[model samples]
Target: MLSYIYALAGQFQLTHERLSDMPAAPPVLLSDRQTEVLKWAAAGKSRGVTADIMNISEAAVDDHFRRIFKKLNCNDKVVAVLRAMSSGIIHL
Candidate 1:
C-alpha cells in the first residue's frame, strides 16, 4: 500500500507540475506517505474512499491528513490541496 501510494503521489506530482496554474513550492521535501495523502486529497478524494483505495482505515486516512496538514503547513483540506497543487505534489 505504501509503495503504491508513493508511486501514485510521484506520478500526480509530476502531472500537477505540468498542469496547475499555481506557483510551485521551492522544492520542499515530503515523506512518500505524506505526498500520497496530499495527492489524493488534492484530487478530491474523500477520506473514506482514499482509505479504501489505499487499503487503510478511514481513521488512518484522517490521521494521515492531519499529518499532511502539518507537514504542508496548511490549515485545512482545501488549503492543503492547493498547496499540494502549487508544490507539484498533486494534479489539479
Candidate 2:
C-alpha cells in the first residue's frame, strides 16, 4: 500500500509538470467589429454606452466582450483591453 501511494504521488507530479510545461494556445485575430468594440471599451465607455453609440443591443455588446475575453485569454475588461492593445487587435 505504501509503494502504491508513492507511485500514485509520482504519477500526479509527472502529470502536473507536463501540464505546466504545455504552451498556451496561440492568439486569435479579432474581427473588425470586435476591434471596434474593444476600441470603445478602451476609451472608457460602458457597455451600455458602447451599445448605444454602435446602435447595437446591450446583449450584443456583452457578446462582443465575451468573445474578446476568450480570444485574449483574459478574465476581466481591463486585462482584455490591455491584451487587445498589446496584441495590436485594437488601437486607441
Candidate 3:
C-alpha cells in the first residue's frame, strides 16, 4: 500500500525538505490517515460521502476537518484548500 511504502521509505536518511520540492510546502508532518482525509477534502468531497468512502463515521470526518482547519489556520474549507495548494500539498 502507499502508506506502507512511505513508512518503509521513512526509515532512511531523507528529510522533509528532500521529500517535498516546493519551498512553500508545509513539513511532511501529517499522519497517513490525515493525508488521505485531506486529499478527499481537496477533491470537493462532502463529509458524509468522504466518510462512506473512507469507512469512517460522519462525526469522525468532522473531527478530521476540525483538526485540519486548526493545523492549516484556515477559517473555512475554501481557505483550507487554498492554503494546502500554496503549500504544494495538493493541486486543483
Candidate 3 residue-wise lDDT, 1-92, digit = tens? 86445434442313453467735535535556666777887787988899999999999988877887788765466556555665667766
Model 2: per-residue Cα lDDT at residue 47: 89
The TM-score values for the models, in the order shown, are: 0.62, 0.69, 0.63
Q: Score candidate 3 by TM-score against the native.
A: 0.63
The lDDT for every candidate, in the order shown, is 0.72, 0.76, 0.67
Q: Which pairs clash in model 1?
A: none
Q: What is the Cα-based lDDT of residue 31 in candidate 3?
A: 57
Query: Clashes in model 2: which pairs?
Result: none
Between candidates 2 and 3, the one scoring higher on lDDT is 2
- Please tell me which predicted candidate would have the highest TM-score against the true structure: 2
For residue 43, model 3's alpha carbon misses the true position, in angstroms, by 1.4
Q: Highest lDDT among the candidates is held by which one? A: 2
Which stretches in model 3 have alpha-carbon errors above 4 Å? 1-28
Candidates 1 and 3: which is better by TM-score?
Answer: 3
- Model 1 / residue 52 / CA error / Å: 0.2
Backbone clash count, each prediction separately:
0, 0, 0
The reply for model 1, stretches above 4 Å from the true place, is 1-27
